[model samples]
Target: MINPLAQFALLLDADLMAAALQQHLPECQAGDWQVTGCEIQHPRYKTYRLAENRDRSFLSLVYHLRGRHPAETTAEQRILYARAYLGQRSQQAYTEAQANGETAIHLAELGMVGWRFPDDPAMPWLAELMDSRQIAELEQRPISTIEIVNYRPEIRCTARYRFAASETEPARVVYGKTYADERGRAVYTNLLTLQRQSVAAFVMPEALAYDAGHHTLWLEGLQGHMLTELDFTVGVAEKIPALAHALAAFHQVTPPPLLVITSQQQLKEWLKKADKLSHAYPTIQPALTGLFNELRQDCPEFEVLGLIHGDFHIDQLLVLADGRLALFDYDELAIGDPLQDLANFAADLYNYPYPVAVIDQLVQTLFTAYSAANHNQTDAQRFVWHLRGQLLTRAYRCFIQQKSAAPQRVADFIALALRPWPLAD
Candidate 1:
């Protein structure tokens, strides 16, 4: 029996297939050009390089033409048709992967299959098709191996493997890193580190790596305890106290050094430069600008500029076996008013489902711990103002984004920000 892939190659080459395609797609034709080999380059379309002799060559394909069908003579219809075809093919490939028991296969990698039969002289064609640098790298690293242990589409890229070594068994290692898309939208990675074999564990969930292309290796996974199964949820009454204690412990540690941010004029210039770095939302830009302005104004009055977790949401906090809450993901860590950190915690509280009494209790516990740690250097009232300003700014940004897809929860949060719950006097 012929290989299924080989059958696919023949189908790709047959006149019948071309004829059928021509009925709907007149541009596609089965010429005397011969197909040596075909390989999957991307998920959208199969690329075929044909040669009449050893020198003269041409490329052609029958791909999904997106947009509307051509009514008269326009490229728009063909483009639309191609896109639709690619979408259908991508879905089909995903369905097949699910049927085969594969977990979260990337649709973009498997869609629109392409491969030449072994009988055909396609190896040379394949060699010629690769980029010069890629070809050189492949030759230089002929013995290298790649092992993919686990992968979640747009979430995590976990792998374990070894580079070529002479005397030793390939060094076994595991890596886990978060992934991002073309738009720079980031995903969270749970990095659980074990300091000892004790029952207590400190799991740190952070943006492990900024580069989406690079992988994160965790050697501890092979030898240390796997605490991924640990349960975080306990009695709702204790969560606030637990979180407050954790935040206090984290804030108590002396940071490396106080980072001096410039005045509002300088900050505006900095923001202008930062705006060019990525495609920030238009609504978010103004709010971020306002946030920087407020911080500059408040910085002189507030002496302490310590290490603060910039985005301390519920997801960033990990509860250990010993009942200690550890903070992780310091990618956005910056030296700012400690109240900014408090604001982040407050923002998280707004998002998470917990009683108002619990929030009050948590705030009181946090203030007490912070005051004790700082030797009464910091005032709670000033921090509250900072928190309020940050909240107002964040609320405005979220509200703008919500305008397009306004959910009830988001609407409620906006309302809450506008008319805040009065703090206990």
Candidate 2:
């Protein structure tokens, strides 16, 4: 039996994939751009990061099924949709090609579907926001420059707006985030609620404004380095108690109405992810299926839903100059099992490109501190269950994200999840 995604596997073959991408991509057709990396963005899409041979400037090119297969969007309709956001002048931004039997739409960074608003100057609030008037906390000044902090094509873009220094005030920086849809409004609301609560264990950067028309959210720039920058093998332990306390305090807060995801729902998602992984890496299908079945058989029936940072990880935490920890990226905040946050954080530690023993020590310290701070609310058995589930989820993410040493990491994570109950001392 031929796997439906067998053809897509070619996208991961660095050599073949790069050759194909360079051949079809309009900008790369001249042979100046080379594929630097590629990762699965969605089941039907992959993003190939290309670098120019001269200066090495990066551009993201997405190979997706726009008006194809499951979506049923026609090629003509897809082209029209992209042109609508990018204007008619963007004739060279996308070109279609066949990947096996599928019609794959290759879109350049600026012409990415559903997320062209960030580059659209004509957006209703863009000029005002770009001019730095949207930041009420800062003394208004002319914009000196703008820097794109991070961009995930077809998802979101975060840019830093730096204002020129005035006689009385120093230059200030504010962040603006544009989403593919109205999701930014909800994240803005969550930040507002977090700010009002003022949880002392940590600080949440201020949410400045939300423009529903353009699906953008503005936030005050924070002065901090991400927690991941700290020496995880050494001094990180000292910060664990505070980190644990912050997470505990955050969990107790009454979050605004949000989606409720239970363990059962998560298991269902994992099953789907497992299916995707099996199709992509056929060799692991047997092992993946057996492990998933075991997890399903042992799945916990009870759940305690509460506020959680849906995607909590070390990178999402920042250590401020004043020694306070600031949390960012609340787009995934939801009403779910609080244990999921703890598990998510712990699971992410395994991917840090460090020694397994070092990661194990850090996770143990984190779990100990969290247990103490949360007043032992973490059920021993349930916590382990959540941990195992989170490990599988992280493993799946590692595969799709194309992280360094991904195959080994996925196997290690799955092995850890299958470890006997206490999860090693």
Q: Which ten residues in a row have the lowest lDDT in candidate 2?
A: 76-85
Error of 1 at 394 (Å): 4.3
Model 1 weakest lDDT span, ten residues long: 76-85
**Mind giving the per-residue lDDT tens digits that candidate 2 earns over 1-425?**
23212333454444564455445555345543444434333222332222222122112333322222223333311111122112222233333222122222434433332222233322334434444445544444667777656555456667898877889788888888987678999899878877787565568878999877767898898887878787886657678889998988899888899998988998898897777667556677777887788779867788788999899988888888888888888999889988888888888887777887787778777888888987876676666777888888877877665555667777778787776755423
lDDT of 1 by residue, 1-425 (tens): 22222223322333443333443332332331222222211111122222223121112232222222234333321110111113235566446545654332232422322212111111222222123354236334323443444333223333433334446454433233333232112223212221222222234433323333332323322323222223223343355554555555556555544344322433354344324211223434444455445545544442555656667666555455565555544445555666567656665555445665566555565556556655656566565545544454444444322222323443344334334334423
TM-score result, candidate 1: 0.42
Candidate 1 Cα outliers beyond 4 Å, as residue runs: 1-175, 178-239, 257-300, 354-361, 372-377, 393-411, 418-425
Q: For model 2, which pairs clash?
A: 67-73
Candidate 1 displacement at residue 163 in angstroms = 18
Point to the candidate with the largest lDDT: 2
TM-score of each: 0.42, 0.73
